[model samples]
Target: MRKISRGGARQGPGWFARRWTAFWMRFSGPGPVGKLASRLAAWLAPPHMDQISLAYLNRRGYIDATATIYHSDLRLGQNVYLGPGVLVVETKGGGPISLGDRAEIHMHVLFETGRGGYMEIGPETGIHPGCQLKAYVKPIIIGRGVMIAANVALYSYDHGLAPDISICDQPLVAKGPITIQDDAWIGTGAVILSGVTIGEGAVVGAGAVVTKDIPAGGIAAGNPARIIKYRNELKNADKINE
Candidate 1:
């Protein structure tokens, strides 16, 4: 038997873990240390530190802010960072969207699901701002260490209409589960449709609309994403557009 390639498995120097650790370290600093760090972080290049604090509070192993939780029966693990205005909804769903520890969710992201459907996000993953994730009747599993860029839309189920049947009249059915394997990078503005699986280590190009499953280590692009290259094995390695 041959060993299957675990391309999407989280490897390297634990970049995300390091950042999370640093956040805690700063918080545990001297009496005035945490505030100073926040000021400095704000002064530094990038987004504000206040946003980071809210995110850290929402999902951190150090503190469980369960009582302030706006939703009941929603599972949030330790060290999971959820920024301000992060909304998780089970409006018509029977289950919940369980988030793993150390997951970073940016501000203004919307998560909604329908009956018996679920959306599960793994640990140390970054869910960027303005992402809309809707699961209807089919579960969506986002693997560990996944990097989802801003404004990404992911739907695990879609409406179906046969030639003989009217789409508006017939009950909506889920195409299938949408599985985003570990270590995958979903570029900014990328849209992943129903029944699509982004394989391990796969890279989805920005503004691309994925209509099907992308193979492991694959780099896909275009309106309806098409395999353009493979990070693990490909002849045109140097020709990688990215």
Candidate 2:
């Protein structure tokens, strides 16, 4: 038999390496040794036992295995679901990122709050695939029962575009706070800028660029997102301001 090269040996055999990688991936965040550590932590740190479990425990709760959560101060509430390839990243910034209970995020979704970061997402919010939310300056609050469609980007901050300082080099800068009120439905590819509040039960049309506040129970669409119609309807069939 020919001599096995060091490089080839280091990489390992194809099948075994793949299997080993998969197994190691399972134990990556908390690691396989967490089985014992988590148990000990739960014992030693008796108070707030849930904290010990969350810090080290890894369990199957119908969440897609491909999802990735990277952060020390990550808070995932009860029964929250994540689909495949969801990336929740908290890098550089030092603060807790809180996700409310029962928030359903679909495939390829990104929730990134790092480098002057904060995120507070409310309960029962359904975020479809390809949604990206980056809150860098204050906080981004997504209220309860909201539905965010695919390819939607809610950015609470932006970089300064002046020629003196390159945007790539500069850090995230917030115009103001971005808040999505309860029961709002943001359509596909909608972009909600900073310092705006989407009122309760408001509808943001697809491909709209929202720059101002959307009134409660209002329907808005298009670039600069004009409020075209009121959501309420009269018994006689006229559009009523809600």
Candidate 3:
């Protein structure tokens, strides 16, 4: 076994060791005991390339076998969970990535930051499976206790569409950061474009393409995400009818 210094220089396992670990991870087995064993192996065995401290593991933070994290400045809070097939990767000129305590990133989610971009996921937030958060030109900040459903895509930058330039060669531009305030709920398949702020306690309906800001306690739906109603309005309506 290769000696891994806790909080030391980031050095991953050799090709052979990585291959063996991948092979070993395949037999995670079928029941509760098997699941427990697999989680333990994922937390203990394989040599990680990032600066994930052993103390985080001891605090019950779980990173699944298939997850890939490649951030230069990575910080993990207590009991954070990175589920299977999750990828935290940097593209070009990437910046810091931090996850607050008890943040859960579910299966198959791709979190990418590049071009001097940064990202911070707050505590008690749960990002469901198949979500893609691509940050560039600005940071993607997800506040505490937020719930983001499956297939939600949030992009913090847009490409410059000059007529002469090929779309592939276009430069990335952004109005500002993508901020999701505390306790917001983003529905499945929603696409949150650059510079939009989803305010605290707001709810975005499924399949909505948000291009503008959604105010706090607002209920937004449809393409371009119109603010359908405020949550407080619903409560008031109920009281008036009674």
Ranking of candidates on lDDT, top first: 3, 2, 1
RMSD of each: 12.7, 13.2, 12.2
lDDT of each: 0.72, 0.72, 0.80
Candidate ranking under TM-score, highest first, comes to 3, 2, 1
Name the lDDT of candidate 1. Answer: 0.72
**Cα lDDT of model 2 by residue, 1-242, tens digit:** 98878887777665464444334324423333533333333333223212222322234212444667776776777656565577888867635677777777777889888666688888888898899988787678889999999999988887777778876887567778789999999999999998889999999999999999998999999999999887784244554563
Instruction: Please provide, for model 3 over 136-208, each residue's C-alpha lDDT reduced to its tens digit, 9 standing for 90 to 100.
Output: 9999999999999999999999999999999999999998999999999999999999989999999999999
| Candidate 2 local lDDT, residue 143 | 92
Instruction: Give me the runs in candidate 2 sitting further than 4 Å from their true place.
Output: 1-61, 234-242
Measured with C-alpha atoms, the lDDT of residue 60 in candidate 1 is 31
Q: Taking the tens digit of each residue's C-alpha lDDT, what string does model 1 give over 102-218?
A: 887777788887786788999889888889988888888999999999999998877777788876777667778899999999999999988899999999999999989999899
**Worst ten in a row by lDDT for model 1:** 59-68
Q: Which ten residues in a row have the lowest lDDT in candidate 2?
A: 48-57
Best-fitting candidate, scored by lDDT: 3
Clashing pairs in 1: 59-79, 59-80, 60-79, 60-80, 61-78, 61-79, 79-102, 93-114
